[model samples]
Target: MTQRRRGDLLVIGGSEKKDSDEERAILRQAARKALEEDGGRIVVLTVASMEPEPLAEIYQKAFGRLGVRQMEVLDIRNREQAYEPANVEKLAGASVLFFTGGDQLRITSQMGGSPLLERIFALHEEGAAIVGTSAGAAAMSETMLIGGPTNRSCLSTLAMAPGLGLLKGVIVDSHFTERGRFARLMGAVAQNPHNLGIGIDEDTAVLVSENDEELTVLGSGAVYVIDGRGIRFTSLSERHPERILTVHDARVHVLGRGDRYNLKERRPIVPSLERV
Candidate 1:
């Protein structure tokens, strides 16, 4: 088993509202935490998006509105740019590193095994807060859901790929409910029963702890955690690619805003209400 590292993660499910409404304050909360941790300094990585500058500017304005004055956008286009010492050095002394939404595969393929990625990992291990929205969120885990069948099926082929590995022992799927991706996530869990499948709905997030033991849900939508540890059997590998999959004994837990979960324990923790 791989040892989990220490770091805070703000994994947004994607399509998070970035306005001033308190009802839609998920991104604001993340920005506030990042500002508090690193004295308002933030590094935004746009490696996932094809149009890096535009995406970076969007976040720049978003975080800027949240009072993050010192924000630098690292527009690393390719693997060659990832190897640049100056580009890699952009992560140094940053209190927070934020990844924008786009193609998760682009992130892993371009930055994987690069010195820049190592620096990002080092900073994360050193207590810097890492934030990802949408594809960025999906790429945080060790096992990532790339592409899969939209319809429910026992024989559906769900593609899996290596991610940033910021969080381990789990797989994350974004735009879960809105996109009707429950079957896809279920297929992923059926294929790899040892790992947990987390399906996060749009406008929500799972705030993961540094120890990787706990996570708290934020935003209006829900977070679904599928645990396959109790799974008795699965015919995902044996069945033909066109056949429906068969899975048994997979436990699932649904969490809403303000709900907390114990990741290591594979259970939900009831929140305590204290009166002031």
Candidate 2:
């Protein structure tokens, strides 16, 4: 029997409102997860950002407003910094680990094989909520979509690399509709049909459950799930990367707030509405 995967994940699609006046429903959930344990703590990791302080400050105030008193910001610049004893110790008591958006490559390259990542995995197994926004969200998958054409789908235009692999068998692309990344995400799914492609829009998020079986949509925008498991054909093997991608029988499901999807079944479960 397969052991159940531990930890919940809040995968945000860039540009979630951080102000006190605005509706920060997504961040609110993160706060709730962080405060689950008695000595509840939150750790904001800014390792992905070039200028980590600003992002760190933003989350510090945001989480603070949400009543997270025990919070710390971890700014790990290089691999050397990621291996530091103090940096690893910072994650000791964290109930929630939030990763800020920037370059997905930075997050993997810096802490890929370090003690920091090992500790994070251990914490995840202990049921810590791992939250990430934009690039940070993209890095949660095993295969990360590094760069590719947003407007068109082409084999040559698509670039993929190894990611943190926090979430397996799924590839995440943030700022989905706002950035018009539909084609690119489809391109990724075309290349790897077994993996599910999730395109998240701005201000939106897909909260992955601790068991990793269900994903619930949260926030204002929609979450697009591209299921290429039923795909019959693809132009991926062709020599021309410039040519338009030809994929057959790719099913797409657009999930709004409160919608749930079963990852194992590869199906969406839309909530029924009541007559007013």
Candidate 3:
């Protein structure tokens, strides 16, 4: 399945370091619409695990004042240059790749199944344009949240792990609603109730298309999306390790900043402002 689109991704939750003008005009209009649909390339800034002096010279000088005048900083956190497959084929010739925040277990313990994460999933299935923020959107979810104890009255270290699924059936949980994280994704979907729980917030972003789980949101915060299929969940069921849960019709969408949502018709759309 060669499913990927060459543009549109600006998952930010850390952009607003006062370079205002509405965050440099939404990072120069999503880097000029991903370089007008992938022709004017180069915007790779994985920063591996980050902190190479103010996050690679301050986000490569603020994405080179927003035109993204070429950038490449594959630090991959030195667990041996993140298991080189020629540095993931030079970050799969990035048309736009950014993952920087920190410690989603150091990116699934140094890029899981590394060949630079299978050439960043073969450069996002040969189309390019993948973005992440806040531990790179909590490790692009197939279950991930390696930091524990939110102390919102839940812990077993609130443990739920595994990630770098690059957005499959979802579970992303960034600095959601400014770190309350709604009981750590409501106890991580009550111990994984058929997955599909995101919590972005903190400048916000949700933007899905390939495989089109029909998400769409942007900056200035909010995106909860819980959707635990029906109300009859049993929290890891009998032989339970202390998780008795029940949620009837559990759905919560609280979007903002150009809202649109339809993760398989869970519905909400109607945005076309046209303000450039």
Using TM-score, give the best candidate's number: 2
Residue pairs clashing, model 2: none
The list of candidate 1 runs beyond 4 A from truth reads 1-5, 151-154, 273-276
Task: List TM-scores for all candidates, in order.
Answer: 0.93, 0.95, 0.33
Whole-model Cα lDDT per candidate? Answer: 0.85, 0.89, 0.66
Ranked candidates (lDDT, high to low) = 2, 1, 3
How well is each residue in 1-276 modelled by candidate 1, as lDDT tens digits?
966455689999999987656655776766765668645578998989998887888788888887787888998788999999999887888878888899999999999999999999898887778999888999998989988866444365777899998888899999999988888898888877888999999999999984888999999899999999999987765548777788888899999988989988888987686611
Residue 126 C-alpha lDDT in model 2: 78
- For model 3, how does the per-residue alpha-carbon lDDT over 129-234 read when each residue is reduced to its tens digit? 6777777777788888666545354442366678887776778787776767676676677666677787887766776764555767777777877877664744
**Candidate of highest lDDT:** 2
Model 3 residue pairs with clashes: 48-76, 231-247, 231-248
Tens-digit lDDT track for model 2 on 1-276? 967457899999999988854688999888786666788999999989998988899899998898888998999899999889989998997889999999999999999999999999999987888999999999999999989876654553488899999888999999999988998899999888999999999989999994888999999999999999999998875578668888999999998988999998888975767611
C-alpha displacement of 171 in model 3, angstroms? 6.7
Error of 2 at 159 (Å): 1.0
In terms of lDDT, which candidate is stronger, 2 or 3?
2
